[model samples]
Target: MSIQIGQALPDLDVDVVEDGAPARRMSTASLLGQGRVVLFAVPGAFTPTCSDHHLPGYVQHFEAFRELGVGVVGMAVNDVYVMQAWAAVQQVPPGMKLLADGNGGFARALGLEFDGTAYGMGLRARRFALYAEDGVVRQLHVEAPGEFRVSTAEAVLQALKAPEAGTTG
Candidate 1:
């Protein structure tokens, strides 16, 4: 089942690229516990939509997301090495974390995993963006296949400004 809105995030242990070359495990609690955060998931690290638009949209709006008091992160089912390479190739923005779900461990935990073997891509994450505060899901925007509307940086920024939205940090 898909993760429901208002549920606390599942236990997710993902690998994150640190500095420029090294990677380390990061827990969901550690990443989302201290503040409002935006975690956007893509199918793969270097796929056309992901590389051309999905990831870049977040990177380009990193400053704006931060200005609204949100920590922005990109999550994919790719390994850390591929994630890091894709980030570099895209000219990753400073302060944005490009996190790898590795074996889709985190994505599976969140019930967001999908088999892409028909396309020969193996396991992958569904496209979605989640907003959390203190680890509880505050808002979730999931996209239909081949659609890219709700997870854009602009949409997230507008949501953050919603009078009735946001989680107390």
Candidate 2:
């Protein structure tokens, strides 16, 4: 089975590019403990849908996420350098943290990695958005293989308003 809601995220270390330099190592626990957070994963950095629609949507609606008292992070199965370059290329806003899940560590911990070698993407993460409050998952939206239906900013915002709210039930 996949990762479930309400469970505390697995403790995992991931690298991030902060302030235009490659620095800082964080764990899932540290990030979630800091505040309510949205952890969204993409197949790869700078992919078509990711660049054109998915991630940009998150950047575009980041404030709405903040107003709901949520910190946002974007993760991909790429190195910190690539993630940083992609962020700069796309002009990512300040509200979201861009994370590099090098070696697919974080995604595997969450049971979210996918084998994309057939498509030349190699082993990577799926497109998914997770809503967590104080270290516990509240909502999770994972997309179909080639679909971008859910896991968008709008979906995550709407998920926050659901009756279940932040529980992983």
Candidate 3:
């Protein structure tokens, strides 16, 4: 089944690249367990939308997300090495994390995987962003096909500052 708000995130093993550490493979649960997290998925690592606006939005708002006690993770279906290179190219800020779901297992498990065969990319994750606290989704924003709204860090920050956001815990 597709992951839903109030549902616990699957314990999927995703490859993460952290600063000052070797590439480590870990479960989503463990990563989210650290604190509230804002996880965003893109269709591809270095696509136009992803490069010009998507990642830059998050990069611009990383400190705001951190100030609100939220960890940011940018996930894609690319390999770990590619993710690392993209991060370096994008100059991802300190507060955000990058994860590689190379095989699309993570996206598939979330029911968010879509065929990118037509675009010459095998399987790509749909553009979406989710908020999880201790691995349970609190507020999720899944973009409509080829749309980009409500998934940006700015939106997540606004949601996090809402009156009822406290009860999400």
Candidate 4:
């Protein structure tokens, strides 16, 4: 079973890049505990889809997310070094962060880890995007193994456009 919309994000320590530098250890709770948050995970780093589209979408729409009062973070099953390289290559701003799930602990805890031995990547995260209020997921978009749909930034934007009424911060 995969992580559902109402689930609290797993508490684990993962690598985080906060200032366009190399990633350092950070608690997942600390990462998601700051108000509203949008977290997108890719299957791998430097891959075609992840490189060309997945991450860039989040990067470009960052301000729009902020307007909705959400902090954005990106993750993948790779290590911190690759995340740093990808961020630098894509010119990702500070508003959006990239994290490394080095051993796939977070992904495994969420039941979102994938076996990609055929592709030479061992365990990896499925393509997904989620919105969390505080630390509980309000929306989760898990994609098909080789497809992208509900996980795109556009989908997130649309979701944030009409949040529930009477929901307090």
Clashes of each: 0, 3, 0, 0
lDDT tens readout by residue for model 3, 1-169: 5688888888878999767356799998888765789989999999999988998899899898888888999999999998988888888876568989999999998888899999899999888888888888888778888888778777778878882542221
Off by over 4 Å in 4: 164-169
Mark the regions of model 1 whose C-alpha exceeds 4 Å error after superposition: 18-21, 163-169
lDDT string, candidate 2, 1-169, tens digits: 5688878888888787655666479877886665689889999998899899988998889898888888888999999889889989877777568889989988888898999888998889889988877887778888887888678888788878783644321
Deviation in angstroms for 13 in model 1? Answer: 2.1
> lDDT for every model?
0.82, 0.83, 0.84, 0.84
lDDT by residue for model 4 (76-150), tens: 998888888888898888868888898999999988889998889999998988889889988877887688877
Compared with the true structure, model 3 gives a TM-score of 0.92
Provide the lDDT at 96 for model 3: 69
Q: lDDT for model 3, on a 0 to 1 scale?
A: 0.84
Candidate number achieving the greatest TM-score relative to the actual structure = 4
Report the poorest 10 consecutive residues by lDDT, candidate 3. 160-169
Looking at model 3, the pairs that clash are: none
lDDT of 1 at 4: 73
Better of 1 and 3 by TM-score: 3
lDDT of 2: 0.83
For candidate 1, what is the total of clashing residue pairs? 0
